[model samples]
Target: MGSATTHALAATSAALDAASGVDLDVATQLFTAARTLADSVQLRSALADGAAAPSARTAVINAVFAKEFAPSAVSLLNAAVEQRWSSDADLVAGIEELAVRAAVVADPSTDVEGELFWFSRIVADNPELELALGSRLGDASAKGTLVESLVDGKVSAATSLIISSIVRQPGERRVRAILTQALDIAARQRGRTVATVTTAHDLGASQIDRLRSALSARYRTDVSINVVIDAAVVGGLRVAIGDELIDASVSTRLADLRQRLAG
Candidate 1:
């Protein structure tokens, strides 16, 4: 992991330590939402999309909490969305850590996203590194030693140990994927600004710039975008920012054309 990610995690950890004043019940509800959303891409996108207004986030709570959820919990969720996250993952991980910090011991050095991404990168970059790390040494000490030597002084001791431990965990699968999920959950807690644009084809650089600018103008804050290409769209674009979707796609047009023809 890079120094920057380490520092960010450390800072968040400190914030959590100091977050002692956040209402436990409220924190718990939000924390649960964060984790649940982390596990669901649809949920994360709905909450984080830039096209979605702040009210949309609250509406989600209202829709979700029909009766059982307290009003305060809903309010807290809205507040988190209003606060805004740099990116969906950034906020998701933030929430995860916040919840974890609430219930368990927190090591500031644990940058789940950073560590996971780096591990994946290492695996992609070097087959030897992957084998060495994934090697099934019956001895925990032996496995840990390999990790320490490979990653020590290279990454924080906390991050190195986490990778090593996770690698050797029995029946443990997809540590990186789980971390990615956690990152999404954390993003929810932090109130991430997410924008999604879908087109018949990948957007060009200019289109991306325009999209970003328009989204920022619409939200009055920086927006993060997730772009998807679908040939069915035919042409034009469909943009979803937050909860709002602007369906200006050729597929929508075709559908309308078909309806008109039927009429």
Candidate 2:
């Protein structure tokens, strides 16, 4: 993230916070707008141009979206385009994040983070399914339909919408990675951080709770843990918290030992 994008995200997040009571369909509209911006390089560049007047950027937003989108959604888009984005990509990603955040706020009681995490796990475990979703040659609508069918009754409405949106327009990211990022975004929306723990086997409920508590204390904030079981881990655990990784797995140790012997 660039400096400009960091500032833009903060501004956009505040705008979404103010629009909490706005229609939930604002999320859908924003997602649509993101897809539009992504498909049009000229439009995206025009909107994110720092040299352009804020009013000029917003004028384009109004001319294109005001009539078609909900009033709240239009207002949010206008706010978004008014900010100085680092790049066209960041502008589009900021809009997408707002869409996800709005959906999360709309369904406050649902376990969206957990649902997304589990869905990512399912995708990670199934290479064929991941390839299908991540395949650029596949029809976007077909991918969206497939995601909707898989998550329909199993996930919250918010989770379903988020999954469908990301699946339909994956950009350059793989399916599972973006899903993991979405789950992290969902956790952040609730003022929590997610720590992914991969172990050779699943941990017990008490063990999970203790780990969560430990991390929460260390980070000075609420923490959520998503446990992934992988036999390839061989033994021990791998924990990922944000950009940091703590690897204590036997496999890593063996790799280090081998490197030392070779050296």
Candidate 3:
């Protein structure tokens, strides 16, 4: 979809090459195969995703990675498929991500904090610019121009080129989705979990902090809030902790009552 697919492998291979002790050629092929699998619609449709059955998913993983991948790659692919995210680009991203982690592990001297800081700062410093890149006005070269001007030689070669490739890909509004999933996977890799919350009312600063604290203590990690003001909610707050929802809103109760009366 993006011109970056071709570049992604090269760039990732180079970066992992620099990361020390990683076999760039293996990483390159791994990235390529995962990307190709993601590009296929017919196979994506047959995956029967989102279940706990690792065996059923393992068959597909074997089909894709058994022939081409190394043992580590096969294991990573199987885990992703078992997680029922095999068909999405995010799953592929997670696999490449494992390689990145391995590279970091292989080189304990790598400045992880510095790298993350640079990426975070770059993203923060150019919110408007990133938004525009995410929005399309056409001109592939111009999009590539933004990547070259903003990202080149700044971060990991793989990271920068991957961002660029996602941007230049035609009609693939998947960068944000992939990044979000990649971040979640990154967090899980680091033994942390993220709980996202939405609110109908403007939670007071203290209330927000308390909620975050409660969620952190309950789930044992920091939480990110997606606060929204929905006047239509009528009353109370709805808290989502992981996959569970605590709906304590008056509006919901009234609607339930209305349905009962009609019945």
Candidate 4:
């Protein structure tokens, strides 16, 4: 991410943290605002242009959204436009991310991060399903309805809303990628980091717990572990958290040895 977008997200996240009474309704309003901005080129440019006066942007926000949005949503939207976004696209993403965070906060008891990970895995493991959800030729609303039906009664209401909202506004992202990003955001909301661990075989529950404890100690915060069973790994494991990767898989080791021998 660019510095401008990073700072903008941080500022908006702070605003979200301070805001009270954030519920699913507020999240829905933010999602609506993101879609509205995304669909209008002029409005998106006006709100995201750093050269424009802050007051002018604020006026546009108020004029377009004042009566339709709740007071909290209006305040949050105003706060978002005040920040200098990396680009018009980032402005939209920032708002969408805020909506996801709001959804996470709204349902404190739900295991959204875990649910998103499993959902992403399901999509990854099924090519036809992934194509159905991520294909550009299909109608976005129809894809969203499919997601809602699939997740209904199986996941929390907030998780269902987040997943459906994302499919409807996927932009250029693949379905699984956006779901992974949402999972990371959900983990962050709970003061935890998500680590993806790939192993040749499924890990035992005790092993996962021990790995999570070790990672939390190393990272100095709580950690959530998502395990992927990849037979290609051969042995050992690969763990990725944020930008860091710890690869000890037999396949990676053999590749490195082969390269060394060739040199």
TM-score of each: 0.38, 0.94, 0.43, 0.94
With candidate 4 superimposed using the best TM-score fit, by how many Å does residue 222's alpha carbon deviate from the native?
A: 1.2
Residue ranges of candidate 3 with Cα displaced over 4 Å: 1-91, 99-179
lDDT of each: 0.57, 0.91, 0.54, 0.93
Deviation in angstroms for 201 in model 2?
1.9
Candidate 4 local distance difference test against the native? 0.93
Model 2 collision count: 0
Clash count per candidate:
21, 0, 1, 0
Candidate 1: regions farther than 4 A off = 1-192
Measured by TM-score, how close is model 3 to the native structure?
0.43
Q: Which residue pairs of candidate 2 clash?
A: none
Query: Which is the winner by TM-score between candidate 1 and candidate 2?
Result: 2
**Which numbered prediction scores highest in lDDT against the true structure?**
4
Worst 10 residues of 3 by lDDT: 104-113
lDDT of 3 by residue, 187-217 (tens): 4434455544445668888987887788778
Give the runs in model 4 whose Cα sits over 4 Å from its true position: 256-263
lDDT of 2 by residue, 103-127 (tens): 9988999989999998998898899
Cα error, residue 36 of model 1, in Å, equals 16
**Every candidate's CA RMSD:** 16.0, 1.7, 10.9, 1.7
